[model samples]
Target: MGKGTPAFGKHNNKLVHVVCRRCGKRSYHQRKKRCASCGFGRTASRRVYAWNKRT
Candidate 1:
């Protein structure tokens, strides 16, 4: 079976959140890499900052 998606929560301690351009799902990762769900990588990914929060 394929690997399951990575978990995202306060306990995981991800450095930043990202949104997938193709799937529009939110995930936490340290670098501007590929989207886990849709396999969209590089320029297709975008950073996500929490509301009223700054990074």
Candidate 2:
């Protein structure tokens, strides 16, 4: 892994598949600490459908 490169399989440390409290949708986001939709600030551990939910 090089600098500035995105790492995989490490969402556990950062908490993967978190559902946005604002939009009530799950996301597979590592960084960018903010919900893609509604710009929420909190997240949870939950897998969501890609097409059905926002990333």
* Top TM-score hit: 1
Off by over 4 Å in 1: 1-15, 28-32, 42-55
The TM-score measured for candidate 2 stands at 0.34
For model 1, the local distance difference test gives 0.56
Clash number by candidate, in order: 0, 1
TM-scores of all predicted structures: 0.37, 0.34
| Candidate 1 C-alpha lDDT tens digits along 2-51 | 67555534565655657655677775333857665555664444434366
- In angstroms, the error of model 1 at 54 is 38
lDDT per residue (tens digit) for residues 1-55 in model 2? 6766486656557566578665777752447777765445543533345786665
Task: Give the least accurate 10-residue stretch of model 1, judged by summed lDDT.
Answer: 43-52
* True-vs-predicted CA distance for residue 19, candidate 1, Å: 1.2
User: Among all windows of ten consecutive residues in candidate 2, which has the lowest summed lDDT?
Assistant: 39-48
